[model samples]
Target: MRERPKIKDIAERAGVSVATVSRALSDSALVTAETRQRILDLARELNYRPNVSARSLRTRRSMSVLLVVRDVGNPFYLDILKGVEATAREAGYSVLMGNTESDPARETEYFNMLRDGHADGMILMTGKLPPAGGWSHLPVVVALEMIEGAGLPHVQVDNIGAAREAVEHLISIGHRRIAHISGPLPELMSLHRREGYREAMRNAGLDVPESYEVRGNYLLESGQECCRKLFTLPEPPTALFVANDEMAYGAAYELRRMGHDVPGDVSVVGFDDLYLSKAFYPPLTTVSQPRAEIGHVAMELLLKILSGAEIDCDEPIILPTVLHIRGSTAPPRQ
Candidate 1:
């Protein structure tokens, strides 16, 4: 049998210490760039491959991270996942994704994977944590949503302020009877957005009747159903602030089916300016959350935690959001 090349052979051929070869292969900044390149060339020439399992055993790390998302079908997660994967690859780490569909059992299964050393850390996009609390010992960073009192690090946008801004825009455009299609209240981000909507209505001296607020699952069908119910009201709203772009599309479709013209009889605003938002009829007016940036920062935070770096747990990283004005919004029809 032919013998496999080893790091020792590469180091000897490059006339560098074994530690230099190791550090260079690991992309360590401690090694000079010139020396690192020379060692890397020698390693390539020798076809020496490090044993990942042995390295993991030595370092007690799997060099892989897990990302838990509630719904993989949502386009909202695409950009975020791109950021996570890019950052992980640059750091010589791999990412494993789990779609829980908001199921507790699925969440628990992924948590067990982390505990069993399948991953070095986790970035949670599901909004909800595992029911069993023992996973707190693992390096975890919550992304896009916050779990109140969890004391876990997180990266998210100002849902409240963004919602308020969206609603305020509706109010400014003479939308006295404004309605909100909100996400499920179980998630803190949804709750915060609803509060912002209420705050905006109150500030504008507009009364938000019970009929004006409807719960949605952040899906198109939910938006369509909710919009239908709202339209049946004796006094329907002239504007809607939907929790997401998918729902906004649904609401618009339903409104048109009911013989109303967008921004002509009704105006619509949505959250998360998804890619399709721009291509939608009359282009959606929505809040732009930096999805990729949120993912990048969240993964970076988890990496820091795994490295035993001190972070300000007292402060959660809050990214800003922008309210985009588009053709979908205009003054309420006289």
Candidate 2:
């Protein structure tokens, strides 16, 4: 078997001290850029790999971060994942992903992994903290959603204000009877969005009847079912503000199945302006979230915490949202 090259070999070949090679490999700012590059090139030429296990045992760090999200299948999370992986790799760290599917047991298992030093820190998109009490001391950053009372560093858009803007757009298009299909009530983002919807209606002097609000599980089936229920009303809503793009797609699909012309019969608006939203029959008018930026900022915050940097938990990082006017929304027919 061919022997693996060690750091000493790279240092000797690059004509640098072992300490300089170590600093360069770890991407330390202390290392001169030119010297670092030379050492890196020689290391690559020698096919040298760092002893990660030895480093972990010595430093008490796994040199990896974990990201726990609620639904890994959602396309909306793809951009976020990309941002996380990119940033982590640049920082000389690895990322481990966990999909909790809203299951507490799964979430707890991931938290346990963090505690066991499998990861140096965690970025949570699940919006729920671990049931275990020891996690407070561990480095964690919440992303794309907020957890009430957790006092953790969070990265997300202003969901309430964004939802209000979406609903307000529907109203601007002469949609007086606007209905909202919200995400599950337990989720903080869902509640913020629902509140935004109601606020917009109240500001416009539009009466939001009890029947206008429906709870969706942030799933396509729930969106379809909610739309069906809304359409059954004697005076159905002419515009819909769905909580997310997937639900918006489902709502549009169900609308067509029931003989409704997309923007002609009922203008539709969605959140999360996912990549597929533009390719749907009619492009969806929706709120565009900075998904990748949110992920990047969240991971950055987690890295800061892991480095013992102080973060003000009182002020959460809130990114802005834009309303993309697309073909799915138009002025209601007279």
Candidate 3:
């Protein structure tokens, strides 16, 4: 028995053309103040509110931002999401979270949603960006771990430098036999961090032996398994440089279970200082990244692009990392 009023209804009531009503509602300069006021009054009298979806189609924007990540459960991503959420909200925009779980198919699905105009902009913080042939059509902003050739704006920490810093810190503490627990192959972020480890080893004139490094899946179990393998080495490393804090925790736990004293028998350093790192029994010494700031800046850049402002797509804002010295690291046992 009732129908929702359309722009046409407002136009009819305001004694103005549909185009004038549209311009007035959008606050375009084409509509005079008198006409805008008249339309506004009529619209309020009719209890009219502009249809967001319909207006989005007309303006080619949804006023929404998409945050694509691998695993939302990981606490590392939470800070970034919070930053994005706060900044986006302040800018009068909403955010949509997308979990791709490092799956190419799911990443493509989210991209499709953005391409179809479900979101005005996107910040990809996961490893799920389409490999190739998926760069042609993209959202207004793309922020993720470095993609080989994907031409999208992003903000990232210097993974290589940060990893190297952690390893080097151990080296400086007299750890000549430093081992590395790396993530799976082809994970750009992991690979970058691994490279940093390698660079540190080389600079120290130490041979990065095959036995001294192990490939991990960036999981707790992987760390435990790799630790066991490392322990069996004829010349076990005195210190281990783990890829992430989560894996480091597991490795250290396993080492203690195996009757090895951490920082006494085997020192360990980790990356991406997670919240639990500090509260653990011996407080993990790891690299502290500005997680929230990265997300905040990425969203800020996307908002600029959405507002039709020019942006330097090639420029990368790499934030610095801090090495928080804790009890997990010490001079290799003499």
Q: What order do candidates take by TM-score, descending?
A: 2, 1, 3
For candidate 1, lDDT tens digit of each residue in 284-325? 999999999888898878767775667677788999899999
Clashes of 3: 0
- The residue pairs that clash in candidate 1, if any, are none
Give per-model CA RMSD. Answer: 4.0, 3.5, 6.7
Q: List the candidates' TM-scores in order.
A: 0.87, 0.87, 0.82
lDDT (CA) for every model shown?
A: 0.88, 0.89, 0.82
Ten-residue region with minimum lDDT total, candidate 3: 135-144
Per-residue lDDT tens digits for candidate 2, residues 112-222, read 999898898899998888776677777889898789888788888899999999999999878999999999887899999999999999999999999999999889999
**Cα shift from native, residue 79, model 2 (Å):** 0.8
- For residues 1-334, what per-residue lDDT tens digits would candidate 3 score against the true structure? 6677788999888888999887665545566779978887787788776676677777777868899887778888888899999888755468899988778889888888887878877888765466555555565455547775566776888889988889999999999999999977787888998999999999989899988889998788899999999999888899999998888998999999999998888888888889999998688999898999988888878866665555676787788889998999889877
State residue 226's C-alpha deviation in candidate 2, in Å: 0.3
For candidate 1, the 10 contiguous residues with the lowest summed lDDT are 22-31
Q: Which model scores highest in TM-score?
A: 2
lDDT winner, 1 or 3: 1
Per candidate, the number of residue pairs that clash is: 0, 0, 0
